[model samples]
Target: MSLYKTEAIVLKYYELKEADKIIVLYTRQHGKVQAVANGARKTKSRLAGSVELFTYSDFLLYQGKSLSTISQTEIINSFASLRDDLFKMAYASYVVEVVNEFTVDEEKNEPLFALLLATLYMLDRGEELELATRFFELRLLNLLGYRPQLDACVDCDLDLAKIDKVKFSSKLGGVVCADCALEDQYAMRINKGTVATMERLLEIDYKKLDRLKVPESTRQQLAKILPNYLQSIIEKKLKSLDFLKTLTMTN
Candidate 1:
């Protein structure tokens, strides 16, 4: 067994037994890691706060045969503000859930780690939650190599600006001209405004996302399309997304 230290964000956790919990973290160096936090369930346990969802911390982990164990941890940013509000918590949950679903264990992705950290910080700081989430989703898709073609048709290679109405093929992984889209029966009609919005979301830096404004119609279009595209890629709906929709409807 070997011991190492790294920075990580707590994605999710599950009770292991009576007092221990299995923490799923997206570490800066280690990617996704599942570590046991002994006595974490007990009141006054030092690991309890550090292991909470969306907490970013530095950890000393002992690598073992089956799972690693957290030996020591220091809180980096608890993102406490996220937990204090229901809306923030729900959006934050969707962010972490996307990370958890897309990533695999022990696969290091520094860009993805940075994106997640930046996104959480933005959400916690009271940025526009829907816009931030959409930005994160677009960026995440890019990082995962599922970036959709916005500049041109995926099938005909025609410039999208020249086309009036376009369709997005989740299977083809980009936009297709109306003529080309006919070949792909699964392609869904996408508005030019929505495509522009998606492109802008992908291009803008996360720090600048606060200044970005998305119209309600565009936001609604994206809200319907992005999740379906993601589900097509991931092969299942995210539980957090369903909960998020419910929360949005109620509020």
Candidate 2:
């Protein structure tokens, strides 16, 4: 059996027979990986902490025909805060879910791995959840080649800044000007502020996200549009998304 090592973040996991677990992780070198952690469910298992959701860790694995086996693991960051706070956990979970849904197994995407780590760190530090989410959404889309045109009309070259009204069409994959609204009759009217907020989130460094204050209105608008836009890409809603909505609605 060949052995390998990688730095990975635990995306999710499932229980196995007795004291084992089947873990799903997104690695820096190898994109998404699924491995079995023998005895991980035991009290004294070293792999226990590393298998928790969102834990960043170094993994030693024995390659298997069906699924690799996690031979060893060392925790880099448990991201305790995300687990301690329900809201924060929900946000972090959503980002990881996005990563899992958009990526395939063993396809290397270091940028995406870094983005997930950064987003998790932001949530752990108690930063702006909505802004962080928007940044992750836009950046993730861009990295995956589904980048939506936020600068101008998706149909024409009409400058959005000079326009008084704009509409976002998931079908067209960007914002369309008023004149082009007829192109996608289902396009939803969008506010300039929301568009600008999305633009800033896409352009600004995530570290300086705090400097840009996002109004509740913009957040609400994003809550409506961005998630729907993202869901439109996948066609089926993510299970984590429904949980997130339930959490938000209850609180």
lDDT per residue for candidate 1 within 1-251, as digits (tens), equals 99999999999999988999999999999899999999999999999999999999999999999899999999999999988999999999999998999999999999999999999988998878888889889999999999988889998899988987889888788899988888878888889989988999888978788777778988887887788788889898898898899998897
Q: How far off is model 2, as Cα RMSD? A: 1.5
User: Which regions of candidate 1 are displaced past 4 Å?
Assistant: 183-186
Per model, state how many residue pairs clash: 0, 0
Which residue pairs does candidate 1 place in steric collision?
none
How far residue 213's Cα lies from its native spot in candidate 1, in Å, is: 2.5
Worst 10 residues of 1 by lDDT: 205-214
By how many angstroms RMSD does model 1 differ from the true structure? 1.3
Q: Could you list the CA RMSD of all candidates, in the order they appear?
A: 1.3, 1.5
For model 2, residues 144-236, the per-residue Cα lDDT tens digits are 998888889988978888767888988889999888888888888888898988878878988999899878887888887888888889887
**Local error of candidate 1 at residue 3 (angstroms):** 0.8
Candidate 2: residue 62 lDDT (0-100): 91
Q: Provide TM-scores for the models.
A: 0.95, 0.94
Best by TM-score: 1
